[model samples]
Every structure is written in structure tokens, then in C-alpha cells.
Target: MQFGDFYYPLPANEPVLQYAPGSKEKAALKAALKQLKSEKIEVPMYIGADEVHTANKSTMHPPHQHKHVLGTYSEGDAGHVKKAINAALKAKDKWANLSWENRANIFLKAADLLATKYRFQMVAATMHGQSKNAYQAEIDSACELIDFLRFNVHFLSEIYRQQPISVAGIQNRVEYRPLEGFVLAVSPFNFTAIGGNLPTSAAMCGNVVVWKPAHTQVYSAQLFMRILKEAGLPNGVINLIYVDGPVLGEECFNHPDFAGVHFTGSTGVFNHMWKTIGENMSKYKSYPRIVGETGGKDFVLIHKSANPDVVVAALLRGAFEYQGQKCSAASRAYLPSNIATEIKKKMVAELKEMKMGSVEDFTNFVNAVIDEKSFDKIERYIKNARKRDSGAKVIAGGKCDKTEGYFIEPTVIETTDPYYVTMCEEIFGPVLTIYVYDENKFDDILKIVDNTSPYALTGAIIAQDRYAVELATNKLRNSAGNFYINDKPTGAVVGQQPFGGARASGTNDKAGSILNLYRWLSARTVKEVLTPVTDYRYPFLQEK
Candidate 1:
């Protein structure tokens, strides 16, 4: 297998598993999903100053329906936020008190249920909501989530028990403890696996979660909740709500009962929430823990000694995968002048053959941007690029079909000018912009990349020479959370790649590892079997 080639099973043309025949839970969930689809969920609009004209802000080109995962939305204007939080809060004590084994069993059962019954449906929902083609969506929603579940089982089973250690004069021991209150998981729309695992891990650790999934991915989020409930998890153990960012984020930040937040979103919002918690630190009964993963303007640097084929393939996948919506997606590339022309030709040829169309088309290589706002951002960037003397000419695509869906052609821009906005900014689209640099300018190019963004999510360097590789790696030590060698920046595997970034990205590093679970909790020491026998008083315990 090639270095950057991650194995993902191609999605089957038909559903792989059937729901249990005539099961009440299945029937109820299906009915709720049907109702959600039947009702044209009000698309919140922005009212004009005159109070008469209202711009239709619902810009989802292919309008997506809410999923059946989290049950139905609340009937009134208040919606499900309060009710969901209350459910999780009410179940907190019972969930926390349950044996770690039993809690782990519930998750195990849920994982089994997901694998057997909802895998196909979940993939379908992810495809529908996020425009991730069937194969990619299945990999994210089913395959990856299953891995996370299995890993969590192993993680908890192996480590939940107390360990004993011998000391010269005393016995030493260590044990894991659960958080005192419920956890809040606010996930983004980009990755379905993250949307599930972020909150699920907290629940696995005996922390109840008040999860608010991204609005754009409501369906898949709802489906995940259903799978959890069907797996025999107590109703109040996992509370899910379909709420807007500002409203739910504010409630979570200000609530006295809030324990911790597992967030994945934009840096601006993450910063705002962090500031809010810091300002109101004393309002909570306990300090509210914060963990998050935010934005990235990740880069891929190719040294003069790098293989042309390897560089092209990695750059293509890194820049265009999931339409370049990933935190680790390669948004910029710095090519050594020696191979710059050859690499550009190969990339252009490969990208030219890439199919760009509706995500529903199984063969489509790239799909629509998430929404109109994102579409507008890319549009503005392209417009600005064109305005700049067409120096950064579109090498392959610049067309966007806005009739029925918001689909932008997978675009490639060629420009050596580092000053181009397209070269420096995180466009977050299937747009790859190349910047060529002379051999002597490699270090200077690294400096330019470091200073380009507030984000430090992920980066890669392709080189054949050991000295070049080591030098590039050392220089880019602080440039990314995940540094790749001769590989693409996309396709983070569960249990292997620890996914996160530094600087403004996020606080909680949700790297699909057991280590991330610690962020959802605080440490507590228990002195077990305290003897009545007299012992030497500790110097620290005794007042001086």
C-alpha cells in the first residue's frame, strides 16, 4: 500500500443490514423521522430594519431534514435545549453511580446496534446533510464510529480498575474517577464520527452529556441519539437538543450546573465561550472545564528532493477531500522551485479528471460548500483573486451551479505570489492554491506559513532526502498539531491519529484517543481503608 493511501471500504450499492422486524423503537424512530421530513422546518430568517422585508436566510441549496436520533423537537418556541439539559442533569446521579463495567456495556451494546441496524441509514443521513458522498460518509459515520466504540471499550476495561504500587514505607495506588456533573458536547457539522465520539466518550466515562449537534447535520446527530437509546441506555443519560449556536452556547456557558464542554467549531466562537466562562468563573458550583478543537489553515510543503507522483497524490487528497472542509485539510502548498513546475502539471492533470457535481452523484469527487455563507466566502475569495490582475488564474475550475444546489467546481489556482489571499487564507473549500519557492527560500517559506494563520491544526512535508525531511520537520514543529511525512494532511484514522491543533484551534484535544477523555473530567484522590492505628503525621498536613 502507498504511504498516504488510507483503506476505506467502498459503500455498498444497497443497504447492508435490516432493522429488526416490527420493533416498536424502530417504528417510532421511523415515524418521527417521517414527521420531521414532512414538516417544512422553519428556516430562521433575518428580519430587515423596516420590519417588513425579510431575507430568506435558509441557504441550504439542498434542504436537509432533521434526523430521528434525538427524538422530536419541543413543540413550543422554547425548543429542546432546556428539556434535553434537564434530562441529562436528572440522570447524572444514576449514571455516575453505575459501575464502570455496566456503563461500558451500554456503550458496547450501542456500538453493536449501530453496526447492525443503523449503519446504512446513518451513512445516508450524513450524505444527505453534509453532501459527503456515500463512501466517505460511511467511512466517517459508521466505520470510524465503530472503531471509536471498540477503542473506548478497550480503553475503559483496561484502565478503569485501580492499580497497586509498592513503596519503601507505604503502599501507593491509583484509580480513575468520574466528573461530578454533566458534560456538554457541542459538535460541528464537518465530521460525523467526531459528532458522535466527542460526547459518547464523555458518557462512557460516566458523565451525562447535554449534546447540541450542529444544525446542518441534525439528521445524523438525531440518528446517533436513537441508537444510544435503543441500546438500552437510560433515557436521561444522553440528552440531545437541536438548537442554534449562540442560544445553546450561552445557556451552556452560563448554567451553574454545567460541568465541562467538549466543543468543535470556529475559533471566534470558542474564544467567546472561553472568555464567557472566565468572566463568570465564580457563578458555577464547580469550575466548568473547557475542551475544544477549532479551525485550521493547514499547509503542505514539498522539498526539492520530493518525489513528484507522491507529492501530487498527497496534495490532491489533502486539499480536496470532503470538499476541503476538514480541520486538517491542506489549504496551502509551498512547492520547491525544482519540482514546482512538474508537480503543478501532475496536480492539474489529476484534478482536471476529478468529477465535480451534486454529492448525490456517486462518482462526484467534490460536493457543495456547507451553506450559502461558506459559498459566499469562497465566491468573495475567487472574486478578489480575479480582481488581482488574474495573476492567480484558475487552473481547472471556477464555475458554481447555484440553481438547485450550492455546488462549486473543485478549483485549482496557480500563483507564486504569497501575497494572494487565496494562498494565505483558510478558504475551507475544494480550492487548492500553490505557491512556488526557490530552494534557498525553504526556511523563509516555512516562516511565511507560520505567520499566515492563527490556527495550527495540521501540516505535511514531502521529501526524499533525510536531511531535508529532518530540517523541514524541525522547522515546522510548532506549525501543526499533526505533522505528516510524505503523506496527505487529510484522512485522520481513529485510534492512530490524535486529531487536534494548538494556538486558537481548541482547548480539548479530541484525538480519538483515551487521553482525550481526561479533559472531560477532573482528578479526585480517595484514601481507602484508613486505619485507626497511629502513624507519623505528614509534614504538609500539620500546621507549621
Candidate 2:
């Protein structure tokens, strides 16, 4: 097949459907949900082309409705992880040697399938499994995953086209090869798109992957794998396994064929994995490429000149969308006292109208946390804030209930101290903390925000004044990887935003762009001389 001469069309970000009242998408989503609710799926571990089952199994339940069992997934042990790694190694040679255009076509087909025939099903799986509302599920599982597939293909082409400059007598070129061995993709539970992207990004670039998705997200992950298989992805190119994290880590990190890791999850887990990989560095064939996107203490800083309505809206959407499960969700806010009162009043009013419950109900704006553990942790934080007399006070919605499901009401805490525990820590739920700063202390507050947390994932500056916006933008340059002006600090689009952060957040690989694709590549330079110097360079001595 022809390679370099072929040009695939560049891809734009997929448009998100609203799924509003009486919409066709809404009707389709409800049907898919009903169909899923009627059956209990049996998910298996995919090793090479084989679907492997184990005696050990784990039940899958929706966070918004924990009593309902959606399915049961086979849980693999350390042996299964090793088998997955072996399968990837076995398939690596042929898969990597295949033409890039053909590999790209497979993923492109997957994207098309996701957009058309499987759109409602994918969204429904996300909703039932992850407890995301219809709109959130559509944007994440359907649009975002499609965006990753299409955009990464375009990015791979761009990388291949990048060649070194040739001198007059020498021809030079650079080849972007996939990593020498298999990649271990560890995905998070929050976004189905992330679960899909982490593995497929490496696989699309010709690297075989041993993927272990978050245990809670396995149901949707299964659907993602099915889509890839249907789109003609070769067997063993990407192996999916459901295994305990520590068990998988021990086997994969110590393996000789472990070439890289593509991860998205907690900071603590990422750091521990990094240390483990370092300790086992000598066992690997080469230094493994480590790429991860971890936790965030994202913020929104509002200025005195900001519009109250805008500030309220940004906080409402940024802090509580998807029940604040997004890695880029705004967990803290710094507001100028001059406009804080009005903003608070408007925010409280708006939040009171928000419905909270199951994803099955389209009217509910907020859903339950991922599980009981998440609900308990967030409840503790809110409880502590409510009990505190000195530094913090509950401004709105500080109640929680776990009877039917792990539900935590969307809460807002106003703190006297800027360094309040809720402000610095990442609760990973629908809890937002506000620190109203003096209007004159904008610069000082900026410093406080920058130094408050170990994370720098995402943040926003809401200001109508151009000077304030520019000042905050420059001052908080290192504070957030994705910065916004007059906007919320969430909802990072694939191509447009290119999301990631530094410091404790992650390696700042900038997923959804060429930068992330570069992480999976190993470059080799080639130079060929037109004229052979068989006489061994006597010209220099003669000239002297």
C-alpha cells in the first residue's frame, strides 16, 4: 500500500449533542438505558483474540443507583497480566511493521462507528456504569472518544511527515518508530473517554498495549473494546484485562518487555507506580516512557470587575458538572470581596434549583459520586467544614445520603482562611470552597492560589478588566496547564485545549495533541552521503 503520498483529512473536534427535552438523542438514550437495565452483562478479559474468564468476578453497579446490578466482570490476577504482556509482545512485530495508513484506517473506522451506529449505546453505557447524565455521557464517551481517535490519526500523520533537513551531498531523514516493546495503559474511572484514549492512543501509533481499565469503569471499557474489534483492529494489538492494580503493576513493571506506561489517575498512585518502575528499571529492555495525568486542585479566581452572573454560572458548571468527577473540575475559588456577595447570592439561588439523583432522570443536574468510598470521603470534608467555627462555614447544600446510592449534595463552603483544608485538598466530588479576598489583595491572593496545592491541572481567571486578566494570566502562568479567561476551568476539548498539567498533576504530556503522540515514539535519524570518500581524506593535509 502507498504510504507517504496518502493524506488523510484533518479532523476537527466532534460536536456534542445536547440531548434536550423531546430530542431524538434523548429518546434514543432512554431506549438504550432501558435495554441495558433489562440485562446483566458478563464481561471477560480479552487476551490476544481470546476472551478469557476467571472464577473471580466483580459486580458492576451504577453510582447513582447502587442497588441495581448492571453486570459482572471477570477479575484477572497477576498471571493474567503476564499473559496480556506476552500477548502484546507476540503481536508487536507484525502490528508495528504494518503500514501506518492501514492502522490509521482502523481507528478512523472506530470513530465513525462510535458517531453513527453505536452512539446511543456508548452514551447509555457511560450513564449506567459511570452515573453521568445524558449530556455529560454524550460529550465524554461519544464525542470526546471520537475526537481522540480522529485527532490522534491526524497527529500521527504530522509526526511521520516531520523529516530532517538534508545538506547538499547528504540525504537526511527521521523515522518515528513505536516503542520497542509493549505499553501498559492504566486508565481512570471518571471519564470513559480517558479510559478509551489512554490505550488507543498508543495502539494507533503502532504500539501494542496491555490495558487495565479502572475496575469501576470496566463496563463502558468493554464497549470501547468491542467498537475497536468491530472496526477491524487486529487481534493482540491491544489486550484488555481486568485485574487488581497492585497485582498488574508487579507483573508488568518488572517485565522485560515493558516499554512504556500511559496512565490517568490519582497523584498518590502515579507516584507509587513511578517509584516501582524506577526500582525495576534494570529489568526492562529499555528505559520505559512514563506518561500520566493525575489529580488536580483546580481553581477559579474572580476579580472585582467580573460579572456576578458569569462568575456564578462558571462555578456552577465547572464545580458540579459530572458531580465534580472531572480531573479538571474547579474545586476552589478565590473571589474579590467587592463582587463576592452578589456572586454568592446568585450562585446559591441557582444551585437550589439544581436537581440531584439518578442519571435515568434527565432533569437531575447532579448525580451520585462514583461509590461509597468517594461519598464517605466527601461527606467527611463537608462535615468538618460545617463543624469548624473559625475558618469555614457551609454556604449552600452540605447534606449527603447513601441509602439508595452514594449521593452527596452539591456543596459550597465559604472559608475565612484561604488555606482551608477543603481548598487545598482534592475531594473529587461536588464540593467547592470559596475564599473571598480583599479587592486590593488580588496579587497576594494569586500567590496564595499558586502555592496552595501541589497540583496545577486547571484554573480560571474571571475578570472584565483587560489589565486584571493579563496580570492574572501572566502571574498564574505556572499555576494551571489549562487556563481560562471569563470562563470556567473545566470541559477541555480534545484538539482545542490539549489538556494536561505539571507539578504534582502529571508529566504535562498535553493529551489530544501531537505532544502526547510524541511520547509513544522513538526517533531514529538517517543520513546517506552521495559521494563515497574511499581515499581516506588526504585533502586536509594537502591543503595545510
Candidate 3:
């Protein structure tokens, strides 16, 4: 069934699932599974009128829709960049003039539409297109999106209704308004919610946005746009495009009206964009805002006093959920030497109990990685682990199911060697590396965790003592933007947990308790007089 302008639902579960292993029912189910695996899930391609007219290289294939063509021009080429900026500038006036109430209502309605009517289709499409597991797709793409939209309305209300402060013998009143120019949103595919939040947050603040979603997540992005349009967002308020990185980057950074870029991706890309913006600083209409969240080599610390259950639960959720694709997904765990053996045993037993199967299988805990490239990357990491001279041993899950979609078993590595490549990189897969810390060399171990990673997106410390937790939290200060005490590093709630990171993670904190909307807006203060006074003498009036 069609969920929106861009989504279709998967076939339903049949009765053959009830059979025991190797039984007739099981045989039929296996055949059905094989057929499903073999089937090519076709996606629709949307084409821009200009691309169609120009007979450009962007025509949609049978199932793939060529939607999201980059702004109708070349990237970096001054003429085309100006054309795109002009298009956004032209759209900004009307979009900004819209009443805050109108924007809020529309956001609410659209969210409701997504949650109630489009949920299943969106879930299935995200699962198919982004290789998200069913639960992750549904929860993150649909449910979390709904939560974000609903929370956004509240955020807007707070921003708009902020009361003027009346200080003793001083007047302090603040009025917030949109940035006058356009915003450029460059999003990633890890969480489809980022697509909605990044652009929606900008539009919420009355900024016109030209959003470029990751190519891999085009379908999900298109479906989201369809929902936004259906909810009565003005035409051109959000301009969707599908262009490559270098081209679009040059265009966005070099444009005169390019107010800022809200980006979520790798550190290398973020750095490049930042450098581009810096290089073209003099050409811009204003100093552009650059808010981004990039890479993360997040960690989990298990103190000697921690509960085994807590460590196990946190690691399972943080490492394996979403196939460890989230920026905050746990990649390293530092354990005290005393509990290292027990923790490893618990982790191994827990991983064994964790089922791995198709995304649609509710009982399956581990799902396929996003695509073949990611699959191969994980395979390579496992191979690297095997080559480790010491300190690294793959305790579980070092195999790939070649016949199926990009599926790899969740891998756990036990190590004392600090130089293990798996321990150092972001990995971005379901490979959790455990390191044992010497009690006498605790400071040295902390230093290793702190300095080993280049990323500071997220980190967590599991300790029973408040002082130890605080000490560890302070020591690994550069680890992540959002640090956790008892919980896993992932699953940050929208408004309550404003998510984003420092260093390579992001410029603007996307979600959490922070005022992220400010990242999308430039403050505008409007003073309206209750009593009109004609041109009276002022202390600092300009001489005519």
C-alpha cells in the first residue's frame, strides 16, 4: 500500500511462520524467505521538470525515481550557484511571513498524518531503502519523527512566548526571529529523523531551506517531503535536491545568500565544508552559521564497582541496536581488570542469546547492515582483528551470511592491547571491542581512552561511585557531546535530550535540551510601541 507519495508497504506475514525447525511448515517458510531475499525491492524515481526538459543524466530507472536533483545548476560554478541562491532567496520572503501558529499547526497535522496513516509504509520503505531493521525504521523514522514534530511545536511556543525580563533598574527584553537569508541542510542516512529534524528545525524558525539528503536515503527523504507538502508547507519553503557532495558543497558554501549549512556526516566532509565556508567568507552577505554533527568513536566505561547486569544491558543496546550505525553507537568498552572476565562471559552469553535474522522478524535482534559497502567494511574490520598480534580476539560473530542480504553477526572482541585497529576506529558496525584496565595503571588507561579516539561525539561511564563517575566523566571530557551515567549512549530523546556532539560529531546540537533552533535562526528584535511618539529628541539620535 502507498504510505505517501513515495512509499510502499511490505507483504504481510503468513501462517507458515508457526512451524518447528525442519518441519513441513518450516520448509515452506524457508522457501518463502529465500524468495523474499531474492526479490529486488524496487523504489520509485522522481525527476525534476528541468532535468526532464534538459534530458539530463538524471532520469529515473523503472523503480527508482529521480527526485532531489540538485538545484537546477552546476555546483561551484558561480553562475549556477547564484541561480540556486536566487531561487531560495525568492522563496524566503513568503515562508518567513507565515504566522508561527500556522507553522506549528501544519507541523502538528503532518506529524499526525505520518504517525497514524503513513507509519507502516514509511517503516517498510526505510527498512528497504536504508537497510534499517523493522523496529529501528519504525521507531526512529516514524515514531521518533512524530515525537520530534510534536516537540517542535512546544519548542516554537516557548521561543515565541518568551517573556520579557524585568530586572531591577534595568530593562531586558528579547525577541527572537528568523535568519533573513536561506539555510542549507546536508543530511545523512543513519537516522531518517535527522532528515526531518534538520530541515524541519530550519523551516520551523521561518527559514527557507535547500536540503540535500544522502543519496542512499533518497526515497525516505522524498516520502518525508511529500508528507511535509501534504501538511500545507508552502511551495519552495523547502527545496529538495539530489546532487553529489563536491558539487553541492561548492554551490552552498560559495553562494552569496548561503546563510549557513546544517550538516550531519563525517568529520572529513564537515572539515571540508567548514574550510570552504571560510575561504569564501568575504563573499557572503553575512557571516554564515555552520552547524554540523560528524563522526564518533564513542565509548562505554565499566568501573570496577559497576553491576554486571547494567554493563551487559547497556553494551547490548548500544552496540547491536541499529547494527551500530548510529553516531553514538558504542564501539569501545573499558573494563576494570577484576570484572573483565565476568563481563566478557556475560557479553558472550548475551550475544549468543541475541537472535539474528531478517529485519521483519520481530524476534531477530540483529539486522543487516545498511548496504554491501558497509557489510564489506565490517568484514574488513573482522579480518584486521584476526591479524592482531595480541590483545584482540573475536569472541563471537566473525562470519557473514553470503546468501542473504548484507548480514553479519554481532562481533565482540576481548583485548588488552591498546593498538588494536578495531579499538581505535569508529567502525560504524556491530563490533564491540573490550579493553581491560589495570587498577594500578587506571590513569594510564583513562588517558589511552581519551587520546586514542579523534572523535568526541559520545561516551558513557558505568560506575557505582559518584566520585568515580564524575572523575571519569571529567577525564574523558573530549569523548562525546552527550555523556551518559547509567544508560547507553544512543536513544537520545528529541526535546529532552538535544543530541549532537563536539569535535568531529556536529556543529549544531540537533536534539536535546539545548536551543538548537537558534542554530537555524538569526535573532531579530522588533519593537512595537503601545503609544506612538513622533520623532522626539533621543540621546544618541543621528544628525541629519
Please list the C-alpha lDDT of all candidates, in the order they appear.
0.71, 0.92, 0.72
Worst 10 residues of 3 by lDDT: 59-68
Rank the candidate models, highest lDDT first: 2, 3, 1
Score candidate 1 by lDDT.
0.71
Clashes of each: 7, 0, 26
Candidate 1 residue-wise lDDT at 264? 87
Q: Give the higher-TM-score candidate: 2 or 3.
A: 2
Over 1-544, each residue of candidate 2 has an lDDT whose tens digit, in order, gives: 4635556667878888998788888898899999999999999999998999889989999998899999899999888888888889999999999998789999999999999999999999999999999899999999999999999999888888888899888999998889999999999999999999999999988899999999999999999999999999999999999988889988988888889999999999999999999999889889999999999999999999999889999999999999999999989999898989898999999999999999999999898899998888999998898784757999899889999988888999999888889999999999999998999988899899899999999999999999999999999999899999999999888889999999999999999999999999999999899986788767667855
lDDT of 2 at 412: 95
Query: Which window of 10 residues has the lowest lDDT sum in candidate 1?
Result: 44-53
**Candidate no. 3 TM-score:** 0.82
Error of 3 at 406 (Å): 1.4
Runs of candidate 3 with Cα error greater than 4 angstroms are 1-86, 163-175, 388-391, 401-403, 508-514, 526-544
lDDT of 3: 0.72
Return the TM-score for each candidate structure.
0.84, 0.98, 0.82
lDDT of 3 by residue, 1-544 (tens): 2232211122121111233455653454345334433444332222211211222323211111112122222122333334545666777877787766677778888888886666666665576556665557766787778777777667666666565756444555566667868888889888888888888888887888877787667757777888887898776677676667887777777677788888888888889888888999898888988888888888998888899889999999999998888999999988888887888888888888988766546577777776667778889888877775755788888887645566788998877677577788888888999888875566677788788887788889888978888888889877778889988988876655678777667664666333777676666554445556586878588676
What's the ranking of the predictions by TM-score, best on top? 2, 1, 3
